[model samples]
Target chain A: MLGPGDDAAVLRAPDGRVVVTTDLLLEGRHFRRDWSSAYDIGRKAAAQNLADVAAMGADPTALVVGLGLPADLPAEWLDGLTDGFGDECALVGASVAGGDITRSEQIVLGVTALGDLGGRAPVTRSGARPGDVVAIAGRLGYAAAGLALLLAGRTGEAFQELTDAHRRPRPPYACGPGAAVLGATAMADVSDGLVQDLGHIAAAGGVRVEVDPDALEVPAELTAAAAELGEDPLRWVLTGGEDHALVASYPAGVRLPPEWRVIGRVTDGEGVQVTGRVEARGGWDHFRD
Target chain B: MLGPGDDAAVLRAPDGRVVVTTDLLLEGRHFRRDWSSAYDIGRKAAAQNLADVAAMGADPTALVVGLGLPADLPAEWLDGLTDGFGDECALVGASVAGGDITRSEQIVLGVTALGDLGGRAPVTRSGARPGDVVAIAGRLGYAAAGLALLLAGRTGEAFQELTDAHRRPRPPYACGPGAAVLGATAMADVSDGLVQDLGHIAAAGGVRVEVDPDALEVPAELTAAAAELGEDPLRWVLTGGEDHALVASYPAGVRLPPEWRVIGRVTDGEGVQVTGRVEARGGWDHFRD
Candidate 1:
């Protein structure tokens, strides 16, 4: 219920712990003004940070935003950005509790999302164990496919959905808490591609993550766009990022939520393998990519 | 005990509520590479935001940072920035809880500080009443004077303190909770100049704030700098910002903490007045100044 208009805002942490995460989205590196409206950028920024909170199996509670704007930016764009933040926060019953604005040469957004654990222990990536089942609970390559379509100038009506996914990822916010309730051992958000993110889990858990590529149900939307672009849809699923999917490891025999589909498993070893093939370093590396 | 390397960080909010605030600092606008070391920028950034948390009468707990850097930025600079953040947070018994890194056209920092109120009510700006004594904790014009010395290229060892103040502000972190314990009715940090920030408290509290210039004991350093620059030290004390001093209103007869010095009083009016003169407009306005 706390709002802006003060030096700082107060949020109730009934569980005695707060979940916090931050993300920075720069104008050219994260999004292009030509490709995304201010509203799209704002929503994407909020979603990415909120997804991080969700990945911790916490209930999103509030967000503090730090925005940098060029003086030449239009007032309407700022208004639209505020609305986008409001709408995205509304999705998880959170509010823009406080924010700071500053002048910058280009648009930059720094968002910190706070969450409540509701008395549950946080599920961390380091908790995965051998023989655990790996599952995912959201779209995988749609955003990447959308980006491909936009870059290829394939903006037909049939490809509008793909482009929209790229502009504003619809993360399955409930899946995080659901997985935690269902006894997930470890979890992470697939913001940096499935294979790459799972690699983090594998590295932390000291186990090998082996994905059966055939188990992945490539959505028709991604496949059609891949076909149009003469690209392999499997690569998008394996290496493309920004999808904001929820991936987790659960012990065998635990009843999995219907939304979570088995795609891989944890085994004795190290690193990530897709169908027994070690994937080359891929996904988003801010400096290198 | 929780730190980085996770999707999100968990902070113990033992008071059952957390106070949060965020600030964005852009290169060339908030700090200059030529004038400030990366460590200086980092410490200043942390100080400003942590001061905001303190202004709310909370004990600083943790900070989440979002950093954007050009690809060519040296690793040593990044390390220095990290050390600066860690050192500043250590000042308030806090930690750098989590952070994100990204590439941008220029360096930018988005910092969010969280605090625990320790069961004390937040001293917001809206609680001042007529006849309340207005007091300040910490320096007033030192930072402004430092900025002046730097701008004038007065690099003599005599002016090094002022220049250092400009590069990094030292806020009175404990004064906030002390003021709250002393029954402060309203409070704010003087980040946007004393007069400008006092206006915020006056407007929020629906009372007039009147300051006596004679009551302010201008530091000799600021006075000397003003003499050398042919400027009025009072102007820097009144309208120059970024000092980050804590100003609060306390009911008449309430004993103030030793750190707080009475410099004014609340009266029946609508805004801030310095020695019977109403400031037309002063302080930093991001879009305009």
Candidate 2:
């Protein structure tokens, strides 16, 4: 436990590079206060930021979180938020470094994550050359499924996992470093839906991405919930977002992490496709949604 | 010319390190729709975060801003906010790297600042040793003075300076890197007024800081405004926060930057003092008005 006090944290960029990312969460827009505790929001916030770090194929090292709350927001809520921040950081042995507090009508949290590449070249979204393999570590569409469950007025012990996923997403933080170590070609977190985010990588990497329908590992809980709502489980997996799962492209013949499953491949094309078909669909759009 | 399609941004950490900081701005608590335009609010939000980076002895390199606004928030207002963000980042050649947006009851901005140390160790608050000279860069009481003017409804052209300071503080971003290059021992942004922020450095460095009233640079404009408000101008300069000025310590005989002025000295003591007198006064506390 060396703590935060330096001019800047000294993270080990063993590959001589650090991966960085940031995300912001706002009350009402991102989550309903009735649905989650302040701790849940805090955990979700940190988890998303750390997931971005993971997407870069790096190990989470430190985080800086800034919070804005209305003057009347309860202090207990703040304490819960801090607890969540600290608790989630403890999961990865990282610490909150510094942040700023300001007044606002609602609560806003901004988190920045710093990560170490651990002697491996960063796995970037731009490196998914044609013929690369796409894989994901952690469950897909859980957050979106959870969001649907809440929207449908489902609760209690039966829907606990879905609710919990919505309130507090647990990203595969170590999987990022693992992918980097395993020489992942390109990587990103599934913040937006798998298809939408992959579109970004496809555009950036100048390669076409094709996801296979048969490869997706749809969790049984999500399948059951989808059935209850008369929704397609594959749609949840492909189109739902915010699972914060690490998705990466690996060179052919490279071994994937234990938890990761091969889902797609790269081609010398211009766009993203699923199951050999071009679908005019996306995960989440900030304004259009 | 290149954007964030890559696995990671190749930011220049000239000193082999980057100084990072973040701030979250919530609507109402930090700003009022009746008082500030979307442009002004956006600039102010970016200014506060940039000021934190400046305090770290680093050059502002990039900023990632996340916005949360209501569905009813006019598109033009969001445009104004984005323009303000772009304008401020342009001030120091920093670019907006990436960000997230969501729906909320009010506008929430989460900003992360990435800075280049330019080949110097970051000047932390704990490095101020005994006999170090304390210096300040940027305005002192202008923001407080502006706040006073706003509160009084005296919003004509006469109070433009004060109002402008309140809306968009001009932090000495370059001074952070300058201090690093000049071997500054300790540094912090004066967001909470000089006296209070000095107390932070003092506590961290285990050295008492003393300010000489005679050397204080209370802007004449503030003096005139304070007279109108029947308040003390020096009080605003000494205790008024949100100016985002950088205060640092240098070893004796070291030449200070032109933008920086010698204001006091560091000594072996328990706390911060002004003019050989101990004062219990400081800046705004979060829980209290």
Candidate 3:
């Protein structure tokens, strides 16, 4: 593993295959200085992209970050961000191998992550087959509920859990490759709303995915927060983005790991269907409302 | 190779290793919408990053781009930029494998390039041994001269070549891996000023790098522009940035490719010493003047 002294970093890919993903986080659009600490932004940025590599059923190896920092930004903030990147990368045994930083008007972070498949076949979104059992491994509506609390100016200690979830979504990192080992047909990271994200799998696989609303256990904290905000917690569970939960379809009758909970099923036809009383708002679209 | 529409791209790293580099280009700091077309900006961004990969003595494989665009930007501009990326990638048989785009007030471009070393040891900066031949394999000072012309509002038919150099630098992509095959001891992309960037190699290698001014051909156009601007052409050749030329050190008496011009030698001392009348501005430092 060649390190940072060179113009480019060299990483070994034992299987002769490499996986790459990239994301752009801009100030005001992705985060606000007033709302999130530089450390949290760093963790969130790294988490989102690492989760993407996980969604591809690969182990993240390194991250190449490109930063556009404001001229007057405090050195302390950048240090905090660097620490955040280190901590997040440590969670998955990855490193901040290389990056570029420059002066700009606002904080803009561009993170690219590389991963290794370890000779295993990639569990792509289009691999889902009919009769597969859809499952999720991690939190769903918590981030959405947390975001709602922040927007309503209700930052209370009692709701800190939800708020923290919004600030940093704890993605199920290992479940990605674990699911692959378990012969997962299709997998995706729930960065967008559950319904919308699953719709991608359905669209790619050309199979109808039906979610059983009863199987989704909305947390009591999310329920209470929703009540305080005069909003439906189930809606958050259905449409929240940034939760970074791993959603995958395993073969029918396959014994799933303890971390995974059955939530839906793959069937003939197309599109994703959530069967219940919740009205689905789809998911977050940056270009649209 | 896995293409777009997946969570992450899968690329074949034939030698079981991957080389990666990243760069950030801001709208005002790196380029201006009024001065450079969107296509040129795209090519410039890709060129800068790809040049870094090439500097590592690797054959560029793919690029992942992250773009932050203004909502009001023209569709035509975006299309042109895409075309530019495609065309530039075509030069090295690379492709825009994947990327993420988000809305921002200004156009921010983040580009990450991946390359394959083809079983050759990476030609790093610290590998330059004393008694090596210092050489260069691309244009020098032309981009700097072009910038001077642009700032002076001297863009005319006669200086089209110079302006084009600044707008879109055509780095000798093949020469990078070619130099490695020729046993280059150390290599670096002259993104910063030549003397300043070579200083990096000197510092890394702990050997003195001596540049002979007589050997560096200051293009006639650069000399003509320097005369009009009352500036030293040799100064530009020594310290101008953004040319993205490949400067390298080879073993003494080794035959270099035809494109390479012998400029100097490596000695047992440290740092870069240009033997001539011009002063070295070192190189472009984003944090300093």
Candidate 4:
């Protein structure tokens, strides 16, 4: 309930527990000033951390930001960044509770997000069982495709959707607690490449996850962009990152909400397996040959 | 309490709320690798933010770090930093809850600390009354003097203690809640310059703060160092920052713990005032001619 201007802000943790997560975004590594506005970077930073809170099956509460800025940077950029953070928090009923700023060589963002479990057990990454169905909510591969498009000098009106995806991701925040309430066994945020992230869940839970590509409809936009760029749309769907999508393993018999798509299954083994998309010959295991 | 390796950490907030604060430390502005070791930087970063939590009348529970490191940074430095964080947390029964690492041009540390209030009302800086007695717990002016010594290229063995104070500050974490229990009307961490931070408490509380000069004992080391450097020791005591000392205002009749020293009083006016010392002739206020 407490806000900024104090030494620290106090957030109500009604369930007697607080869920906390943090993420760092560097200027050149995570975002580029020419490609994304400060507002976009702020939104993306908040989204990724907030999505992590959701992945824990908690309701997002507040975010505290630690920002590093160069002295020559414009003040309007900071205003835009603040507005972006506030708008993103508004989307999920959360607020920017506190922040600290310092001078740096380039823009650096450290966002810490907190949440409350609301009496529900947190969904961890190591709880998947052999018979569970792997499901995901929110867009996948969009941000990666957007990044690729921006890198290719294709930031025209036709590519705006993909570029916007890279600049500001719209994470499905509510689906995290929703999945938890529905008894999701294991969960994670798809920030890293999907296959790499799924591998984490598999390794932690001691179970193999097999993806069913048939369940993922390659979007028309993705297909058109891939065709023009000589890339594989399905590959992006399988291995891209930064979508901040929620991936969870639910008991096979449990009914999923409308927003969730059953894209895979948990099995008695280790490592990620993509059905109907064998790519053992590729330099990288998950990429197309 | 849940640890790292999950989507987010779960920390029990027994009082139904969590006190949270964040701070950003950049390489050139906040610390220099040549002057402070990675371990020192880590400990200093943690101490500053943890002290902020304690200043809110809470016990530190956990910390989440967001680190942006140069690719050329040594692995041993990272290890030392981690050890320092863990050791500092161990001192107060807190732990490292979660962390994120990213590539950056320079080292950037963003630390978010959480705390538990233990059912006590938070001792905010706006609660001081006209009759309150101002007291402080922890060192004053030591770090500032140390910094001056280092900047002057006098980091010899004789100045080790003073230099060390600048490298690593020891804040009295327990004094915050302890002050609250003893009826502290207003409290804040002396992070910014003492008079400047007191100005914050004064403005927020809408009462004038009259600092008693006789109450502040200029350390002998500071006096000796000031003589050698041709500086004023008392000025450092009155305005230096980064000691992270806990300064609070309590009812005049309340008995403070032994660690606390009465240093000032709340009076019927606005702005910060120094008793037994006036600087009306100085070009700028709060300093001697």
Distance from true location, Cα of B268 in model 3, Å: 1.9
The lDDT for every candidate, in the order shown, is: 0.88, 0.78, 0.89, 0.88
lDDT of 3 by residue, B106-172 (tens): 8989999999999999999888999999999999999999999999999998888988889999998
For candidate 3, the docking band is high
Q: Which ten residues in a row have the lowest lDDT in candidate 4 chain A?
A: A279-288
lDDT of 1 at B124: 92
> How do the residues B34-99 of candidate 1 rate in per-residue lDDT, one tens digit apiece?
999989988999999999999999999999999998899999999989999999999999999999
Q: Write the per-residue lDDT of candidate 4 for residues A1-289, one digit (tens) a residue.
A: 8889999999999999999999888888888999999898889889988999999999999999988888999999999999999889989899999998887778888899999999999999999999999999999888888888988888888878888998999899999999999999999999876777788888899999988888986888788778877888877777778889989999998998799999989999887878866522122354443
lDDT of 4 by residue, B1-289 (tens): 7898987899999999999999988888888899999899888989998999999999999999988888999999999899888888877788899898888778888899999999999989899999889999999988999999989999998878888989999999989889889989999999886787888898898888988889898989999989989999988887788889999999998877799999989988887877767422111254553
The lowest-lDDT stretch of 10 consecutive residues in candidate 3 chain A is: A280-289
Give the number of the best model, judged by DockQ: 1
Please report how far candidate 3 places residue B167 from its true position, in Å: 0.6
The sequence of per-residue lDDT tens digits that candidate 2 reaches over residues B7-95 is: 34534444555667777776666777788888888788888777777777767777777677788988999888888888998988888
Indicate the worst ten consecutive residues by lDDT in candidate 4 chain B.
B278-287
- Arranged by lDDT with the best first, the candidates are 3, 1, 4, 2
Q: What is the TM-score of chain B alone in each candidate?
A: 0.96, 0.93, 0.96, 0.96
Fraction of native contacts under 8 Å reproduced by each candidate: 0.92, 0.40, 0.91, 0.92
Off by over 4 Å in 1: A276-289, B277-289
